[model samples]
Target: MSFGLVNVPVRLFSATENHDVQFRQVHEKDGGRIKYQRICSIDGEEVPYSDIAKGYEAADGQMVILSDEDLGSLPTRTTKEISIEKFVPSEQIDPLLFDKSYYLEPDKTGLKPYVLLRDALEKADRMALVTVSVRSRMTLAVLRVREGVIVLQTLLWADEVRKPEFESLSEETHATQKELAMASSLVDSLSGDYEPDEFEDDYAEAVAKLVETKIEGGDITETPEAKGEESEVVDLLAALQRSVDKAKAAKAGGASSSGASEAAQAAGGSDSGSDGGSDGGASDESDAGKARKTAARKAPAKKSATKKAATKTAAKTTAKTAAKKSTTKKAATKKAS
Candidate 1:
């Protein structure tokens, strides 16, 4: 079904599902069947479904029972259509606003319409804010295309999210200006385009594989390892500097690898055109040649930097120890004299 001004063709389907193993109620001792009881809160009495009534307790333990007809009498806008209200930049919506995702498929004849809508959305880089009724519940949703398929994600209302007060958090002044600058530089150096494939549900995959192993009659065991948790840094500046340095190193490694790969490709192409007889040798030679040159140029600079840093650190430590020893000796001499 197509909807709204954008003509988004959406066939609603759930995006997520529960994968947990389900268990039924049973007796603990003999493993017999167990039954659940619906009891009245005020009295210690069991109630049958027929006798149960919905009630709201007011002051002084006063109660009012609401009938099915009475509940239905309440005013509500019940429209089954996923009505899109407006289009907005996807970035404008806070991630906390999203609740659940659903796959949306176009009707058989709605393919062209669907593509048009998808392309339009992709071009504008916006998501459609939609209101939809599902299973007697009204939901606010954001609609977008994922891999050429329309996806509708249910959203939580603004009031549903809790706001954090900045004042409640501890205010600690730390991190030197130099550290902050270095950290920023590192972040910039390592920054790259986001590829969703780069992230994976490792925990989910591990759990699935473990389940498979258990099903195949493999024994499961747990290994305990000492957990080393670092204390929260009060020094923000120092932490930032360390982060920057780490980012820079990672970026340098990535750049070097990319350069080596490009060089290898160029060499391979050149060697391939020259003679088909030595293709295998050519490819290997090209790869090795690039690797050697990259290592020769980059490794020495890295090693030199490390050596200088180590030297400086050792000198500083030695000076500090010597100063402490001299202070102690001066105190002893003064007392003896």
Candidate 2:
């Protein structure tokens, strides 16, 4: 069934693939089936499933056995329906919160509602946060559209995530103004429209291909050694500038291709309108050329001076606050004496 208000008819399917190599159990010594023993940890005695009981360790090496009835007494929600609690910005949730994904399809009778939900979500540019019970456990998840399909992703609770305190990382110390600027430029250089086909698991694909080749009795050739010495960038500013230049070049290339397509389309339209006359063709060409030039002129600047100025102002303000704190501390010490 489709999920969402837009009700865009969709089938939920997996967006990711799992190609992990699988292994099976084997004999340990005499090439015979190896069996495992179910024994008690404390007594080292074999125990049957019926004879075993769940227990929790307490202080001073004490143990407390828990019965099935005791566990059943604990309150638990049993509903199987996916409960939609709220819709939050996709960015607001951490990527680490996501665990597993499942695709959703529109049921025959629910097609209209499904399509409605899909269209609504797509237009609003929002994601639905829902809770669903699966295998006796309730899970928090997000519902979103991917390639005209509805997908649900299970999320981990906040308590399950470890805090960043263990790393003891100071944001101020690690990210300097110069490094940040360079990193921002690098991000800008690499930024483009999201295309899933552009990325692939190279390692996994290479391994799979190699396995296929080996199965076909093909001989593998030695890989060539990598050449050229790696040079360290001494000038950070120069590196950032170079990255910005590369981004501008890439954008220009994309615009040029788009312009070419528009020109071709205009030529075809003019040819269809007239019986291949030179006057009509020339007029269409002139209009297409002007539109292309206008698009090229609209290209965004590589560096934003306003953003850089704002960062510098923030840094100065922080420095002033620290200086004031130091002065106040000194005045308080003198008064105490």
Candidate 3:
């Protein structure tokens, strides 16, 4: 593609594709492929492919017939060259603007120019805005280097993107200091590096498996509807508290397990020698020590809870004794009188 004074002979490739299972309509009774014939409504007759021609309907319902020759003769820019308008900072473009991505490979002749541009763009941290005609549509796209390959990310027109204006946000909504702090804590607890490989298209996988099972003549089990753990809306504060606690507990549990594993390794390393029995004993003792330390840390809260329960019981008993003594005194005084 020619851009300004620089021309790069690069191969164009699609960045992504769909691997979804496709289904076709079939006659249920005969198990034959079902097809529909294109028919003209006015004549009530089946139409051949050659009889079809593009037509546009006017506002008043008058059809404008467009001949194949007329369409082919129409003036349109079908340029193979991609000319760069300008380069801009990558941050200036919104992520929502990007629609599709395509990888560009450099030819032997364009290798030098392609590498120069790639390295230059990498240092400048910018994307080249360019206009390219693909599939007869003139689209705005960005050129940037990704993993040593030039990737062209096509963008949607400004008019295509919608503004996030909604009725709910018209009025102000605010959170209290404590709620905000708690929410932040919850976020922090769950914060981790995003590994894209960790995710999968579960529904697609299930469908593929279903197809395989049918092909193998195996019994297929109907999938049950997913059920949520929480059945009803809970108090906001309480729910946040539970979420934060669960996250914290999970983190602590993970850390504890990791520490135990490290400790065992360390203990084994120090005690390991000609005697395997000694090493095993040391590792077991190290684990026991960790367990005891964990228990000791939790002991204070448990003791405090037990003490409060005993104090409440004692107070109730003392109040009951005082009431009995007062009643006995009143009866004795009345009898003496």
Candidate 4:
């Protein structure tokens, strides 16, 4: 890696590894592995991997065949060294732009300089914005310290990250200070230092266990599906308050109650109208159903009140019109006499 006037000879190693279970595609009848061949569309002949060349299809339906020689002559050839451009505050870079990461180890000759750079970065809380050519493509990358080792992480180009165009996100929304306080309390209740060791990849472990079971002549049974939470458009303030209370209760005595109970308490009288429905006898009505029922009850009352007021106003108008007509008729009769 190039660092100003000093060059640090370093080796790059992948920072992460996948631990997913692997599967093979095979013929059901004979258990033979399924294989594919590369065939040319024009000639209908199978082509060997050695004869394959990269091809790009144009907008006008023309194929552009690129040979090894043509590709090699391109400007974006791999550079052996990582060139540091500048250093910037690490917080300024968005984590969303981070792509792939590699651990950089220094050669014996460059050990001192490597330690110096790493210590400087950690001390200053900055990342070195660098450019590195990898896989025949020049890409922008950053060098930062991770667990005392310098890590080089590639970044996506500005255009690669898309701008979200969600309608709900564009719409104006507001929340009361009370709701915010409750949400903040909930967050505080659950806040802790993130330790990666505290979590495990359950899916991977389950897959490995399943394969082991099959290998041991065990019968494979379907895993029980977890109960899904009912979709709800809950009152934000009520939900936050419930969450905060639950967290506090859990912290107090390690005793906890079901979320359903909390949701029911939060809903209060919202479920009253639900009894009139066809599923009124159903005790397992969702919180969303309760909210809907509450809205239904309120809407009819508002409509009925409006209608009654309108009817009374109409009756008064009719009586006033009749009285005015009688007075006008009497005045005309007296004038004529």
TM of each candidate vs. truth: 0.51, 0.51, 0.58, 0.60
Q: How accurate is candidate 1 locally (lDDT)?
A: 0.66
User: Alpha carbon lDDT of residue 213, candidate 3?
Assistant: 82
lDDT of 2: 0.63
Tens-place lDDT digits, model 2, residues 131-162: 87766778888887788866789889999999
Better of 2 and 3 by TM-score: 3
The TM-score of candidate 4 is 0.60
For candidate 3, the lDDT comes to 0.70
Q: lDDT of all predictions, in order shown? A: 0.66, 0.63, 0.70, 0.71
Deviation in angstroms for 146 in model 2? 1.5
**Model 3: how large is the Cα RMSD against the reference?**
31.1
Off by over 4 Å in 3: 41-44, 58-62, 174-178, 218-337
Give one digit per residue, the lDDT tens place, for model 3 in 1-337: 6766888888889998987767867555544556688999999999988889899999999999999788888766688777789999999999999989999988999999898988988999999999998887788999988888889999999999999999998898999999999999999999999998999988889998888889688554443322233423345557889999999767655544443444334333333331333333344444345434433343335345434343334333433333343344445556665
Better of 1 and 3 by lDDT: 3
**Which scores higher on lDDT, 2 or 4?**
4
Model 2 quality (TM-score): 0.51
- Residue 305, model 4: lDDT of 48
Poorest 10 consecutive residues by lDDT, candidate 4: 252-261
**Candidate 4: tens digits of C-alpha lDDT, residues 57-143:** 999999999988998788985678899999999899999999999999999999999999999999999999999999979999999
